[model samples]
Target: MHLVTGGAGFIGSHLVDALVESGQKVRVLDNFSSGREEFLSHHEDSGRVEIFRADLLDMNAVKKSMQGVEMVHHLAANPDIRLGTEVTDTDLKQGTLATYNVLEAMRMEGVSRISFSSSSAIYGEAEQMPTPETYGPVMPISLYGASKLGSEALITAWAGTFGAEAWIHRFANIV
Candidate 1:
């Protein structure tokens, strides 16, 4: 089974669709803060998809969701950059800290694979228009970006220390 953290959101819902179409079982964990149930309503009757309405901040819930999951597609985070600026710690709690809880839960559950949705914002002011993943001097401009970078660091550390496999994708505008 696959676990998609933000599976009710735009991108996540689509991913769930693809997974279901491929005959894979999926478990979605979302808080509905920026997601809507209607997005995933199509899979309601499909027994292949299970929705877990919860937040990543809840450690016990996160660990429970990890049970029997083979891979984790972590996409939950603060959706609004403006909100992050207005509420200073929104990104910290929702992004970085939440990712930590997910990783910890995975560790406790003995799940070793994760695919993280990162952001190109990690490369703050770059000289190159299309920054490569190997870009140097990552300087984030917003709290959201900082949280993503921190999450990336945590994921990296977790992979190295626990021998887990991680795939971090830094996305820009997803039009």
Candidate 2:
């Protein structure tokens, strides 16, 4: 089974739809903080999609949800940059800690592959207008960016140590 965390949000909901259309069994783990239930309502009748209302910050809940899952698409996060500043721990809890829980869960479950939705914010104030992947010293000015970078590091370590494969995607502002 394929697990899509934050599968009720905009990007995640669309990803779930595409996965469902491809005849894959999908499970969703979402807290609904930024995600809406209405987004997955259409798939309620499909039987191919299973929904679990849970926060990624809860490691036990994330571990429970990972049972029998072969792959994970981790999308759950505090997407608002402004909120990260006001709520100091928002990015840490949602981005870094949540990612740690997911990786640990995957390790315990023996799941081997993971796809993460990271951001270009990790590049921070780039000396180059359009920073290339080979750019040096990625200094992130925002809490959100730092959190993403932390998650990426954890994922890389998990992949190397636990024999898992990870695809870390650094996305630019598409929306």
Candidate 3:
């Protein structure tokens, strides 16, 4: 079974649909914050999808979702960049901490594969347009961006430390 965090949200929901269409058993862990149930309502009738409403900050909850999971698609985060500035702890709890919990859960579950949805925010205002993957001196201007960059680091470090494999996809904007 495959696990998707924020699986009720815009991107996650679409991903869940595709996974289920391919006959994959999917487990979705979502707290809804920005994820609307309407986006995933289409999957309620399918036996392939199981939705678990829980915060990733809760390690036990994250662990529960990892059971029998072979791969993880982690997409949960503070979606509002402006709000992240207004509420300083949003990124730490929702983005960074939540990601940490997921990684630990994966470690305990012996799940070795993870895919993360990192954003282009890590670049801040780039000096070089068309930022390459090897772009260095990453300076994120917002708390949300910092959290994303931190999460990326955590994933790679976890991979190096624990022999886990990871795929980090950096997207620009989600419209």
On a 0 to 1 TM-score scale, where does candidate 1 land against the true structure? 0.98
Q: Give the candidate order by descending lDDT.
A: 1, 3, 2
Write model 2 residue lDDT over 1-175, tens digit each, in one string: 9999999988999999999999999999999998999999999898999999999988889999999999899999998988988999999999999999999999888898999999889999999977888886999999999999999999999999988999998888757
Give the Å error, residue 24, model 1: 0.6
Q: What is the C-alpha RMSD of each candidate to the true structure, in Å?
A: 0.7, 1.0, 0.8
lDDT (tens digit, per residue) of candidate 3 on 95-173: 9999999999999999999999999999999888799988978999999999999999999999999999999999998
TM-score of every prediction relative to native: 0.98, 0.97, 0.98
Off by over 4 Å in 3: none
lDDT computed for candidate 2: 0.93
The pairs that clash in candidate 2 are: none
> By TM-score, how accurate is candidate 2?
0.97
Off by over 4 Å in 2: none
For model 3, state the Cα shift of residue 136 in Å: 1.7
Q: What is the lDDT of residue 83 in candidate 1?
A: 94
How well is each residue in 1-175 modelled by candidate 1, as lDDT tens digits? 9999999998899999999999999999999999999999989899999999999999999999999999999999988988998899999999999999999999999999999999998888778888988898999998899999999999999999999999999999786
